[model samples]
Every structure is written in C-alpha cells, then in structure tokens.
Target chain A: MKEEIQDNLIQIHDLRISIYSEGSYFDVVKGLSLSVCSNEILCLVGESGCGKSITALSVMGLLPTDVAQVTNGEILFRGQDLLKLSASDMRRLRSDEISMIFQDPITSLDPVFTIGSLLTEIIRVHRNVGSSEAENMAVDALEAAQLPNARQRLKSYPHELSGGMRQRVMIALATALNPAVLIADEPTTALDVTVQAQILERLRERQREQKMGMLLITHDLAVVAEVADRVAVMYAGEIVEEASVQTLFDKPQHPYTQGLLGAIPDITARRGSLHAIPGRVPPPQVPPPGCEFAPRCVHALEECWESRPLLEGSGEGKLRCFNPQPLIT
Target chain B: MLIVLLISSVAVFYAIRLSGGDATAAALPGSATEEFREEFRARIGLDKPIYLQYFAYMGKILKGDPGHSITNNASLVEMLKEHGKNSLVLGGAAFALVFLIGVPLGVLASLRRNSWADHGIMSFSIAGMAIPNFWLALLAIWLFASTFRILPAAGCCSGKQLILPAIVLAFEGIALTVRMTRSAMIENQNNDFVRTLRAGGLSEWRVMGKHVLRNAMIPIISLAGLRIGQIVGYALIVEQIFSWPGIGQALVTAVLRRDYPVAQFFSLVLVVLVVLGNWLADTGYTLANPRLRRSR
Candidate 1:
C-alpha cells in the first residue's frame, strides 16, 4: 500500500483555486485533491464551468495569473511541491516532466508555424540537439502518433490538416519528450465521432508505452467508460465520488454520481424520455450551503443540507456524502 | 494599378481645368494683350476641347513624355526626377523610424500591459494622434533649430536637415503602428496557441517573440502599407512647413502657379505610389500568414 501510494507521479493536495471577476474573487476549485499514478488514466469528469480545465491549467502552471489564482494548495510532483518552485524551475519541469494537450486542436496550434518548426522548436528548447536531430525526432514523434506521411506533414501548417490530424500532432507534441505525466483536457472533444476513437486509441497507446500518468479531463461519460482506469466525478468544484472504473460504474456511491450514471442514454431500454438531473451545477460564487450537489441530488438527506461531508474512504474508493446510495446487487 | 493611375490622372486633369484657372494667363506676363494670350493658349494646345486635351495628355503620358511645365517650359519628367528623390528619402526615413521604434515599443508595452509603461505609451499615442503635424513641425524647429541650434531649421541639402521633417511626418504613423501592434499582439496572446506554447515549457520570450508577434504582424503589415500612403499626404504640409524641396512642395507650387503638366504628372505618381503600397501590403499579408497562402 505504501509502495503504491509512493508510486504516484503527481499528487494534488487540497488545491483551492479562485477566479476574480467584476469586483470580488470566487472559489472555483474548492479544496480539491486527486492523484495520478504511472500506467494509469485518471479521468476527471465534470460539466462545463465546473473548474476542471482550470485545475489542469493550475497543474501545468499555465493559469492566467491576472484572473485566476491558486489560493491554497500543494501540487507535489514526485515529492517536490510544484507551487513553491520558482518560475524558472517550474518551466524547466514543464513538458520535460509533465506536459499537456488542450481541448480544441484547431486553435491550439499556432497558425503561422509549420508542423516541423513547432515540433522541432519544442524538442530543441529542452534538449541540446542540433536542428537536424530535432527534425528527425519530430518525424519520429509524428510517426508514433500514427500520422500518415509524417515527414511530408512536417511542412504542413495547422489549417492544412484535418481536425483529427491536428489532434494527432498535438498528441505527438505533448508526448514527444516522454514526460512522466500528461494532462489531456478534452483532447478529442472537437473531433468527429469516428476520429475521436482513433485519437483516443493513439493517446492510450502512447500513455501505456511511455508508462505516463495521464489525467484526462472530459465531460463525456462514454469517454470515461472507454479510457479511464480510475474515475473521479466532480460536482460544483468538489469531487463527490471517486473509484476504480468498474467500481464507479457498477456501484456509484454518491447520489450525484448515481444521477450521472442514470443520465447516460441507454440503448437497450425502450426510450420514452431521457433521464436528467433536476437542477444544474451551482455557480461558483453562490454555491448552496452544505453539499454543493444537494439541490440536484434526488436522495439528499436532511443532514446533507447542514454541513459538507469530507472525502472519506479506505482501500477501494472515496465518497464525500453523508447519505450514500445503497449498493446495487 | 495602371487603371487606377489612369482614372486618377483623368480626374485630376478635369478637376484642375474646371477650377476656372487659365494656364496661359499664369504662364504669360500681366501686361500681355488678349490676342497674345489667345496665341499662347493655342501654342500650348489648350485651344482644343477638354476631352481632346485629356486624350492628348494621356497619349503623351503613355509614350513616357510627361510634357513640359506651362510656366517654365522645364520638362515635367526632369522636375519629377529631381524632387521625387527628396520625397523618397524623407518617406523612407519616416517609415524606418516608424517600424524601428513603434514595433519594439509596442511589444514592450503589451508584454508589460496595464503597467505604467503601457499607460505611458498609450497616452503618448493618443497625444500623437491628436496633435497636428504642421504645428508639431513648427514647434520642433523652434526647439531643435531656433532654441537648441542643434539641427538645421529648413532645407534638404544635408542629412542633418532631414531629421526634423521626418520626425514630424512619422509621428502619427508611429503612434498608430504602436497602437495596432499592441492591440494585435494582446489579442494573439490570448489565443489557445499561446497557452499551448506556455504549457510546452517554451520560454516566455520565445512564446511572445516568435509566435505571438508573428501572428500580430499580419495586420500590422497592412497598417504599415496604409501608413506609407498617408505619409505622402502628410509630407505635403510637412514639406511646406520645413521648406524641404520634395515632390509635395513641387505639387503645391505647380497647383498655385497652374503648371498643368507638372501638377498632373505629380498627382498620377502619387496615385500610383498609394495603390502600389496597398498591393505590397496585400502581398505581405499573404506571405506572413500561411493559412492565407494555402487558401489561395
């Protein structure tokens, strides 16, 4: 158990992020904690505006400093606190130790730069290699990402390629340096259904081959079911429930998690009306008292409205609910 | 471009003719008799109808003969060659000053955005846009030439004399370029690509200079081209103020004296240069952005 805990490449401890707007600051990610281990995929599932992307940005130290801030937290990467590291030191660690791919591939790459230049520059930034060597490495990365005509594609600009191809290039760039951890924030969201599978496959292949701890952020439960080793369900800036993929799917403990599982469109059942949670995720600035999901949860108890529950668990999973739903079967 | 020059020349010719000025009278002495004026007008081909005179002028221009000034009989081509050199020099110096100073300063201001430096640059740009160039030219002469006695007050014989007028001409251009560069860069800085670059651990300088600035330069290049055209118009007034012997001064003198051939040729040249500047800007826009190139 100790060895497994120690094997985590990145462990975020009680990270609280705040966003400034108009006049005052609002707590967005309220004391969230999660960990990513080598040879595993941890999917952080949440709807839009639930602070998932900002959390990923905070991990990369790429948050917009003027608007968002990490008020309290410790992001420990391999035992060193990332938040305490100097800007230069943090920069040295980025892409070399941990890298990221954004949601929209079309706008994520510089339109003016050729694929070869963009890839080669990144390789050269961290390595003391000549241009030719960097180019060779870039070609290799492109090939690994299953891009056809990898060498020829080097001369291509971002707009010249299809959305799927660009996402593959993004995957190539993020994994080229063989970082220990990769944060893919809805990487395939902008892609078509057919292209999404291919991108996910390539991403999984890279993550497994490199033994990289990948933190995949997405709102799609089908994606979570397909790619996640562990699943963490976030509601209103808090992780309501987290478990192994099988455990989370088979027996979702928290009421919010149960509602999410029920909301997935079922093909077998005769469809009369789709299942939907009653209410929406509360705004960060005006979250309801006690459990943030109380208004939306169907099985909320009286105690759930008085005080928030801490994330408590042992070996199999964690649940932050005073009134957890009964286990099925 | 050639079509634009032709249309512009025709318009200038008719407009100048309809202004009710007799070129023959301007060319002749005040004591000349009506019969002598009639002979002078007939000698210069002004006795023909307006459209016929335009056709003759256009035919002569097509054959590379700009004709002679009605006032002095000096070849219009020769006057153009001599004075065009000075305008070219002044315009080039002004453009050089605009880009060399505006781009870097704009980059710095954007990188340090919302800081005192950015505020200062923006405030200076507003002031630059508000102040009149001719008034600024006079003040510059007063400060640098009359008061400090460091630079020459007027004329274009020495390189030192080019400084005051060039600065005056480039002031608004620099201000506009700075504003454009800053806003363009700031907009590009917010793009998803910049975040990708930063996440990839590229240095801030690399992210900003190589990617952001390059993207921002597309619009800035077009602005630069438009500014070049505007500088010609500004040069007219700036030249009159500084007494610098440029084509602008020549055009004004020709207009006042009703030197038809000289004025018509200079107006055509100005139109051609402005159109050519826009063409260059369009070409530069395509070159700077690969997306545009691929689309074509």
Candidate 2:
C-alpha cells in the first residue's frame, strides 16, 4: 500500500440492514463499515447472497422501504449523514454528488423513453439548463464514456442497442453529472466476458479522470483483481477484511479471504479441478451465533465458533479473525 | 384485420336472419293486401336464395344506400349520422372522465402502497365494479335528480343531464382503468427503470409520472380498443336508460321495430370501428413500447 491522501469520499459506519416479512424482521447486513477515498476504486467482493448489493443500495438510498430498511448506521457523504436527511434533500444530492448504475443495463433504462430524454432529464433535474444545452452535455458525457456515434445514439431506446452499448449508456447517464461517488452494483456482470473487461476499463478510466470514489460491487475475483485499488471481503452480512487490493490478495490473513483467492481458477498455470470454499453462505435469517463463516473456514479455531471476531489491525489492512494466518508467499 | 371485418359482415347477415322474426313482413303496414306484400318482398330481393340475400345486403352497404327504416321509412343514413354524433360526444366525455380519475388515483394508490389512501382507492374501485351500471344509473338519478333536484332523472339535455349518464357509462370503465393503472404502476414501481430513475435524483413525482406511468401506458393503450367496444356498448345501454337519443338508442328502437337493415348496418359499422380501433391500438402500442418497434 502506498502513502496517499486518504481523504475519504463516502463512509459507511456500523450499518445494519434488515428485511421484514410476516411481522418478523430478519437482518441481512449486520454492523458493517468501509470507506472509499477520492480517486480510488473499492471493490466489495463476496459470494452470491452475501448482502453486497444491499449494502451498495443502502448507500445510494435506493433500498425499497417495504422490503428492506437500514436499521442502523450512517452513510456519510461530504460530511453529511445521508440517512438523516429528508427524502427531497437526499434526492437533490443524488446524481449531483452521488449516483448509481446497476448490473443489467437493459432493464435499468426506461423502455418508453429515448436515451436522449433519459440523460437530458437527469441533467435538467440537477442543473438549470435548456433542453438543447442539456442534450449537448449528454452527448459529451456519452462520448466521454467512449460510446461511438454518441449524438445519433441519443434517439435510440434501450432495446435498440446491444448489451455492451446499453451498459455504456448507463455509465454515461451515471457519470454525466460528475458526482463525487458512484456505486456500481456489478455493472458488467450481465455482459459478455470481453465486454466486461472493456466496461471495467472504461469505469477505471472514468474514475481516474473525474477523481471520483467508486464502490464497485462484484462476486468475481478477476474483476476485483483488475479494478480494485482497495478490497473488502464480506461473508454473510459482515465485512471480514478490508485492505489495499495487493495486500488482500497477496498476503490474505482471514480464512474466508484465503478461500476466495484459492477458489479463483489459475488461468496462467491451467490448474485442473478448481478449489471451492466449503459450505454455502448461511441464510441471513438464521446467521450463526459466533463467526458467520466459521463453518466454511478450513482453519477455524474453537474460539472462532464461540465468539465473533471484530475487525482488527491497521496500516496495510485489517482482518477479522481470532487466528489470522500469514500467506506462504 | 380485413379478414376479420369480412367475417363479421357474414355473421351480421345471419344474425339478423336467425333473429326469429320476418323483417319484410314487419316492414309492411297491417292494411296492405297479401298480394302487395308478396310483390314488395320480390321487388326488394328478399325472395332470393339465402346466399343471394347476403350478397344483396353487402351490395346495399357498399352502395351507401343504408336501406330504410321499418316504421317510418326514413333514410337510415341521416338517422345514423345524427345518432352517431350524439353517441360520440357522450362516449368521448365518459372516456376522458375515466382516464382523468383513474390514472391519478391509481398512481396515488401505488405510491402510497398499503397506506389508507391505497386502501381507500382500491376499495372504491372494487365497489364500482361490483355495482351494475343500470343500478348505478338509477341510483345516480335518484341522488342527483330526485333527492338533490339539481339534475334530470331522465332525458338528454344540458351539461347536467350528460353527467349522470356519463358517470353510469364510465363506472365500470373507471373501475377497470383504476385497477389496470394501479397494477401496472405497482408492477413498474418495482421495475428496474423506475429504480434507476429514482436513483438518478429525479423527484418522486417526476419518477412516478414520467418513468413509471410512461411504461405503464403500453398496456393501457392496448386496452383502448377493447374499451371503445365496451364503451360504445355501454353507451347504448346507458342512453336507453336516460333517453339520451344517442345511436345506441336508435339501434334499440330499430331492433324493436324489426328494422333489420338499420340494425344490421349499425352492428356492422360497430364491428368495423372496433377492428379499426384495435388496428390503431397496435400502432399506439408500438409508439408507447419502443421495444416492439425496435424488434421489427
């Protein structure tokens, strides 16, 4: 890890999210915290059903209140607690200081509206501009996102474009206002592998150019390796490790983090029989009493089964484990 | 679409024949001799074979003759034209009222979701659907005309008279529209685009009115064709109850008088209009839903 400014752009502190049904509440995200500094990409890596997407949704204030709610925690952006703000006030801050793009572009853009309308409307909402001026700004944003023939694509609806092109349009819409934070919830997961690389590269380029703090959520280890400046590994509902990407991958300490790295196929050496972590993520409704990932960890200790580990350590990274192990490398 | 119209014409011809009454005999006055009636039937081509009679009916419609009335022997064209205008005005007003109330209420219900406002709107629409139109018409008349003495109980005149009939005409339609709009809006509120729009910083109103409602319109517009057929059918029934003198009223009178040509012509025209409406709805559907347009 290099010595950097460390000026955090967005901070989630002790956040807990829960889903409610039939008069009973089940917590899905339990007391988790992480940060993204300006000009950095923080990849939230986890297996499916690990509450990664819900955490990202909470940050953007997009959680459906009837289904899920942020029961605890503060999402601090620009020194303001987002959860405490009124809905209207939060809306004004959205797409201006914070924006989001989703995993599937096809379903994320309004099918009845043109790309031009979708993009320009967002700009007009945040800024006082005439339609023509907004249109020009939208065009420039699309061009900045590396969409070819950007001006003409404006009239096209979402379905008229290919998946890659639509994703590019989504990137264009999200970044057009130059928000301080961008929460991308697996933006390229629905795209082709080739398009995935291109989209990730484009996002990195945008993050660098805008000096934006990006919270990139993904389950793919390769994506985390390619794009993350920092990595946070979540299991069940809690973040188990937070560190600079190099340290998390090269000197992983937590057993779950080690398992994730091991699970990644070795493309270079062409290893046969891929490795997998034992057991699946426990359903959030009935999370284990002690360490949530203890059942899946190969090096679990008796202490790990008796009590949960708090996120500890400093400097290069932090690990939440009673018995943190050093990698052989 | 054209094939549907042609088939509809054949159905109309047989429907009139199988109606269990002799139209030509009904057309003749009681004082006429049996010889004169026979001569009149032969002159009008009614004495021809069944297929020939079908061809003759089609020919009359194509020639724009419209045949004649059974009771008064008046020109069917002029009567239809007048009645058509009245029904159009009444139907258009009812259509506008249904949308005006249904859309905003549905949106409010969906946005409020499980709130009192949501329950109120849903319960009101259900009640509207449960009550029959004739019963509603009678109740509205009693309330507005008899109890309040502010409007007429029967007959079409004044904007006030138009109100009760239109309300009766719009009741089920309004109920349908509200339910459709509510379900579609609720479905769309959970849609990806709506989430994207909301996350993009647009105001809640803008998201609901623009993004959610806009996508929901595809189904609503598709419903228009079926609605128009229903609206027209509803208007006819409503008109008879109110003595509104609309086309539906005229058709009812013609049917009772055994005015076969007049009745058949009106049904055929209605069929054509419905088919045309459905065809137009396809275009409307394409406009509202861009995905269908792109696939072509």
Q: Which candidate number would show the highest TM-score if scored against the true structure?
A: 1
In order, the B-chain TM-scores come to: 0.97, 0.95
Each model's DockQ?
A: 0.87, 0.84
The Cα error of candidate 2 at residue A279, in Å, is 1.8
- TM-scores, all candidates, are 0.97, 0.95
Instruction: Specify the poorest-scoring 10-residue window by lDDT in model 2 chain A.
Output: A1-10
Off by over 4 Å in 2: A1-6, A268-272
In the range B163-209, model 2's lDDT, one tens digit per residue, is 88988898888888999998998898888888889888998889988
Write one digit per residue (lDDT tens) for candidate 1, span A1-329.
78986788899999999999989999999999999999999999988888899999999998899899999989999889999999989998888899999999999999999999999999999999999999999999999999999999999999999999999999889988999999999998999999999999899999999999999999999999999999988888888888999999998898888877888888988857988889877888787888998887777889778888999995559999998877653
What is the overall TM-score of model 1 with all chains considered together?
Answer: 0.97
